[model samples]
Target: MRRSRTGRRAGAALALTALTVPLTVAFSTTASATAASSCYAVRGPYQKQAEKFLGLRVDGRQSASDCRAIRAFQTSHGITPNIGYAGPVTWGVMRVVAQQQAAGHQPNRAHKCPTDRGRIACVDLTRQISWVQDGSKLVYGPVPVRTGRNGYETRTGAKRIYWRHLHHVSTLYHVAMPYSQFFDGGQAFHSISGSVWSAPGSHGCVNMRGKDAKKYWSLLKNGDDVYVYGRKPGT
Candidate 1:
């Protein structure tokens, strides 16, 4: 599922500088020479592998070599000194760079954050569907969702959900999904046991704990800031 996400690059911003540690270089890219398309704007196979294997995916039209070049760029930009140089950190940084460039904030980098204001309220990476928070109150959700495996994760920054759920039952609240995926889509998040960060993992969607599922279901109301997003898109 393609995601509309944005945030200040962790290390690219002052966050890392304040800590006196350089940003970690963790991604390499290979873009096709045909165009200057941004990685975030292009989603391809590497994006799939990056998300699945590294908990982060590549965007834009970068080739494997472009991915590698991205790593070199980060290294030159003082991202991090001689480490992996190509991983989730790179994706996170690129998000910042892409948005910043698009917003005309920086020359080639990004500073603006991304969000799904009109996009889907929730997304199921494995299921490839965005969830409706409260089709009635929120005027957006109350839709369907396929959360993570264990039900213990939801990314931060994409959406800020402040509302709570009553009757706290994902299954009862959003009747669009089945019994299996409905395990507890309430507030819990998703993430596979091992790594690979592939489609199998939580993919940065909201996982739910069975116990808290029904509780949140019975508690959430309208106009809540469902602050979502912690992982990157493609993760």
Candidate 2:
């Protein structure tokens, strides 16, 4: 009788274990499914603003695609970490850009520009835009730009273009830097890969789009003035 009772207890323990295993697995699976579907929420009108700026569908929701687009924008603008989330810092940058666009205000150009310079390349670090001016006349555009990342901050001051290279290669990074124009030390203005528009930043140079860089190469010459001003937001 004692042996029979012990065998019954062992069988009962195995049955209980079998029941608990499936329950635990089901709970874990449910939790994982919930997490996979979880989405980041953008506060206020920033969703619409970012969508418009990125040319994404404005669905008023922070979907995975929206996050990817925001990450691309943040990466291009030198926002750190590139976590693919639209948090406060990301939203703040987007908000300022949206407001500037809405008001038709050219960032970092509200103050008086230098009149003595003949042909100038004005870099607005705040807005990540660059333009060319021939003595107060707008010669080129407010095109998108990618400046230096943290620790390799681009110098913000007056500089003069000292050299021009139509096809240059970086000895340090071993990458192609087309339409290179040296201004301050090793820092230069050049055309980077299209990935820069969806990646981090350059070492200590001002990066421009391919077409803009070509235009710059044609418009600017050696000894021209390159004025870099303002601070990149969320640096």
Best by lDDT: 2
Error of 2 at 10 (Å): 45
State each model's C-alpha RMSD to the native.
21.4, 9.2
Q: What is the lDDT of residue 76 in candidate 2?
A: 65
Question: In terms of TM-score, which candidate is strongest?
Answer: 2
- Per-residue accuracy of model 2 over 145-196 as CA lDDT, tens digit each: 7788777878899999998888999999999999999999988889986643
Model 2: runs farther than 4 Å from truth? 1-109, 195-199
lDDT by residue (tens digit), candidate 1, 22-136 = 2222112233332333333343433543443333443434455555565455554345421323455555444433432342312112212223333224443322223333322
Off by over 4 Å in 1: 1-65, 68-129, 133-146, 150-235
Report the lDDT of model 1 for residue 199.
28
